[model samples]
Target: MTDMNNPDNGGHGEWPQQQRPQYPRQPQYPQQPQAPQGYPQHAQYPPRQPGQQQPPYGYPVDDAAATTVLPPVPAFDDADATTLLPPVPPLGDAETTALLPPVVPGAVPGAPPAAPRHRQPVQPPFQQPAQQPVQPVGHPQGYPQAPLPEGQPEGRPRARARHAAPAPQPAEVFDPPTMTLKRPPAPGPAGPVGAPPVPPFAAVPAQPAPPAPPAAPRGRTGSPIIEPGLQPALITAGAAALLAGGAALGQVALALVVALLQLLTAAGWFRLNGMWPARQGILLAALAGFTADAAVLLADSDGGVAAVVGTLGGFFLLVLVLQTFRPSDPKERFYALTVLGSATVVTALCTTLLVADWVPAGVGAVALATVLAAAPLPGPKQLGPVLGLVAAVALGLLVGAPVALGALAGLGALVGRRVAAYDWPSRFVHMTAGVALPLAVAAPLIWMATDLLA
Candidate 1:
């Protein structure tokens, strides 16, 4: 390689042929990877030396060729140039005039002759009338007139007279004449002034007394005291109470009865609230009841009531938490919580009977009361509740329980019946809640009463 800056090169900076270094021929590999099909193959360029400067890939290397001037393009002439667009059709004078191009003074040589002007016959100039003509009397001008009557002539004098009459004017308002009302003079020994005298004992034909208006048929008042299906409800209640009293002999047996009552309470409560198909709520409530019963059984006798109450509170919190996870609107969540919480409480109440010692006597009183209340005795509606209370007291005396215990049990049973009957309970309600609720309700009362009496 020769030095590019060497003066002996005559400032041309060219590499001399004799001084160029010999390089070894590159060894060809056996195979070169071919480019994949459809791809453009790039030319392999020889590697350049660090000192060599090359022109850009697309440009000519010679300086004179790069600077050569290109031929001048011919000036565009409108007349000779051909266009891709279709020829313009000839324009009418109106269209041409609308274009507003500079106007030539004379007629265009090749243009179509101007359409001959047909001067419309000159309309006589409208002259002002000496006097404005009067419009006809009846019909105004411009607006369409109504057709003349069938029998009337177009120029009848009578019809003309009718139209000519002045339209009646509206009456003026005036103060009405004022008069004072006076009471008639009463009949006396002198009688009315200038009236004929009547005999003292003369019988005037008695005017028939105005027939009294038929008294409005009185609408039926108040809900029926005895709900329908009371008979079946009474039988079911009595049977449940009897079974509960018998189950009192064994703790396990009583637990079973209580469990059954809990199930009925859950199912019936859901139905009562019109929340059918609330499988989750029903299962949750039933599970809570079972847990309460277990708690009661595991607890010491003294702690049984506390166990039930605590179980109730814990399950209520669980219900609230579970409801939070429910994918429901706030209204539906709130409604579910209310129905489920109430059902849990009522089911838990059944556990009280297991802890109470006077359960048999209390249950007996409940049965007696429910049976008496259901009887269709001939008396006022009050008689049923009255008889129920008396029967409960009598039952208590026979069973050797305190009078207050029996009364409390009886009252609780009646209340539970009322609850079951509310909102027009169906037959299913009568069978399930009507039977189970009486005992469930009485349980708490019996437990409390026994505690107090003890």
Candidate 2:
């Protein structure tokens, strides 16, 4: 195909065409052109494909295929203009030979004439001057310098000088005199012999002092405590007693146990649940006592009296607890009421289930809902009706239904006096009713168990 980028093809060629002198085509020959001597035509070749050996001529057969030319190319100096030109690869050996001067196979232009190399002049070997015989100087009498060889360097050959370093003048010794000497000698026939003339140059070579003795080790003496597991053993023993049903003795025993538990929890023996574990202890003890009393009642018909005594003691204890510790704050009041009331309700329900065979299971649910709904009524003045309702419920659980109704009416009349203020006396009615309610229910079961047991 014709190259369109050519500028030498005249206007007919889409560029300025070079003035032409067309020549006849050369005849094809079988022989290849020869290269000059001592110069390689093509020895370096790129890596070949596997299983394909290189041509002996060091180039691909496609060299002849790249010979097509359209026209003289337009020269471009700028990189942007060069984009219009067709690409050309670097020259091969044959192409490179065409660009250089024709080689002449003859002698080199700058070779020197051949001859044998000249030898350097030699000098005689180094010789030392004769050494005069050495005389011993500053050496001790018996020692002498050894004879030197002819080529050896001269020096005052070292005599073995002992480097004794003056025996490091022993550190100055200061010995104090324990006693003084008498100044005058006794007078004799020679008149004391001139006081035993002292020496003019006496040297008292200083002597080293004795080293100090090492100190004795200090002694430690005290009575050692041998107890390893004492605390844990004590705790285990106490825990055994607590878990062994000692709570049934009386309220005093119950109170002490509960108090000990609170103190231990406070002291971090166990985690403290809250300000007081009274509520939890009360509930636990109540459930335990109720369960025991119920089991006894079921097993022995005559065990009512013991149950009654125990139940009365426990219920009275819970009442005394509630009354003695008045609420110190609003939250304390709320919590006290919630805990005490819930425990009392649980105890009451347990007693009801044990004693009253006629109570439907739905009674507990109905009773709980009524108590919760009634507790939050508006003013203290209205507490009379609340107390009356509470007394009614209490009497209903203990006495019969008719007497309970009478008690509710009676409570309303009693609490109606001095209702607006914080009436401690009036509040007592509600408190005492709440206290009496649970015990009234429990006392019967206890009495029944006692009678059977007796």
Candidate 3:
């Protein structure tokens, strides 16, 4: 008997090659006889008893008087195996989201799938590949590199490079989250690219020193004591003196003009004293008339110049002595003594010479020139003095003074001009200079020349 559980029939697992299926499609055996209960399902046909005869291997079996009609088997051929498989059925409608069934391997289970089939890597439900975290993209140098997350493959060089360095951020100045870019140096040879240079500092120029302050007022350290309308009152007195003296004195109105000039001098001094009380003494001018009359008398005598010089020195010394003894506070005694004393002496000398006809018929020229010298004309300040000198020269020549003498006298105003420009104790510090200098210097020379000519 042949046993199914023994796999080969009659103890043979496979038939010899010539005795195997002769066609391309191997025929499936008819349903095998199943053993009873749990004996075995697949089994070969039961053994024949006694001396039964075996059928030949290639012969076909047919049973006479069979009830069922069977489909005829096609004759076997030995060409390509295309006709071996059953025809494929038409595809039916299916949902798009449905997952396709995995293709089961036939004989060779260990081999890779064929080209037309998919072969996904099998992994356990618990061990699914870890999803990578997203990273920001940036320049390679901009950000620092960190270790990659777990489970990522080593092949992603580009991803690693991108993740290693994040994008650059804008720098802030006032906030100072990062250092701001240094400012570019000024355009110069001192600085070069990549290396910054120190900048040069400019020197601020020094301002000029301020001018000295004007003279301070004096007299009890209180308000200035000038009377209201003093200038007008003095001018009216002077005009009256002129009219009265003109009638009383004889010849060419000498007393009238002298009185008027003296009154003018007093008024000028009074105004100046009020302007700067600390520096001038109006009292000295009251004594001027007395000295002036005596000087005129001495000039008519032989030794007049010595007498004049002595009188002037004595008056100057007396002023200094008075300053030492009286001791007035808030008063600039040095300035008062020097300016007042010099001015009074100079005024006396000028008046005496004017009254005494010392210049030999040149009074009109001298007087006009002196007035012009002090006049406030426009253009250069020097223009006033220069025009005055030229006028003196021309007028003196016309008035019978010699050209040499007139020219010498005209140059005298140059000294006066220098004094006029000085910053003096008072505005009238130049009173002596502007009024007395030209006449005092020129008159003496004119007198000598006239005497020599005579």
Candidate 4:
């Protein structure tokens, strides 16, 4: 066991190779964690208070671990020019504070912000806390009890305020409003209402139920939103009559037909409906028609339409331009244009019809017919019919129509007025009649004129 002379052996002046001292496993107090490197020692943690109890191994250091739980890293502020470090627990038991990752280097001044360090979630030594004593409601010393009133026992719960009689409710203080009494004189009034012996109720005849409205005419059940007040029929009648009269008489000419169609299309549909685009189209068309009419009349071919188209076209153009400039819903612009244009065209066509000739009288029979057709006869009773007949007769004779023609016109006008008055046979029926009747009346006259000329 003692090789004293050997250089490698354990001997005096040569310390022997020693084995690590093995001691019994003493109670291993959890090692405290050291302040992380690069962090100021002072910022790491405050010293533990004396007499503070340490938790058992693997248990939390209670307040010590809690204090360090939310690390107070310095704010990433450029003004301080300081590096932040997560608050490391005091250099003590490693169990209290697990070794943390090294402090992340902060951004150098004038550098782009450093990408944030992804920190591992600290698993706090979570344990249900020991039950603490129940705290007093207010101050720890306890609130002062109000002085007990006379006749009350001690510790009886104090009322928030001293009790007094409850204030009177409104109903108790003021009597409620009631229905005003119409009390009769005390027992003295067995009077008038009771005096009249009740007459037997006379038997009431049940009034006949009001007659149902007649069904809509067949073939036209859909709504009639906005048509000519007989406008379609009016056009057909006027167009057919114009064409027929022009063809049969040969003296009347096609200009009147053109004018009638233009008037009907513009005035009847477009203009009335507020179609601005259609109105503009009509104005342009009217201008063209005016030019054509002027050219034709100059050439002695189309004499029926006068240059009045130009005037109406200009007016309609102005209106449309104003409307175009006006603020309105964009969707309605086209319709508004059409309506305005059509109306303008119709008005111009009226002027054309006025100047246009059918039988060569200066006023023009076609023009007179056009006027009558375009106008309305809406007086209450037979007033329209009477006036219309008189006007027809006067106009017919004044315009040098035959007496037969005058009588025919009067009859036609009267019939048309009556038809118009009765709303039954569709609005178009009377309107067609109003426009067509004159042409029918004039047919015979046209025959007579042809015969005489031939």
lDDT of 2 by residue, 371-417 (tens): 33234456673563455445545634553433333333233222211
Which rank order by TM-score, best down to worst?
1, 3, 4, 2
**Candidate whose TM-score is highest:** 1
* Winner on lDDT (1 vs 3): 1
| Residue 278 of model 4, lDDT score | 51
Which pairs in model 1 have colliding backbones?
A: none
Which of candidates 1 and 4 reaches a greater TM-score? 1
Candidate 4 ranges beyond 4 A from true positions: 1-293, 301-334, 337-341, 344-380, 390-454
Per-candidate Cα lDDT values, in order, are 0.70, 0.36, 0.46, 0.43
Give the per-residue lDDT of model 3 (tens digit) for 193-223. 3344332435557789999898787545443
Q: How well does candidate 3 score on lDDT at residue 314?
A: 74
Clashes of 4: 26
- Which candidate achieves the best lDDT against the true structure? 1
TM-score of each: 0.50, 0.20, 0.36, 0.27
- Please give, for residues 1-454, the per-residue lDDT of candidate 4 as tens digits: 4354554332233333474333355697786677799975544455645443334345556676567746677666543442353322222222222333222222223458646545544443333343342322322232234455898765333232433222211111211233221222221123342143222346567899999999988774544432224353345344545564564554236556545544444423332233334544565545544444454455443443324544655666776787788687876766666656644544344334323333333123333433444456565534544554556556657866665444443554334333333423444433443343334334334434323332
* Each prediction's number of clashing residue pairs: 0, 25, 0, 26
RMSD of each: 30.7, 35.5, 37.2, 26.7
TM-score of 1: 0.50
Candidate 4 residue 174 Cα shift, in angstroms, is 25
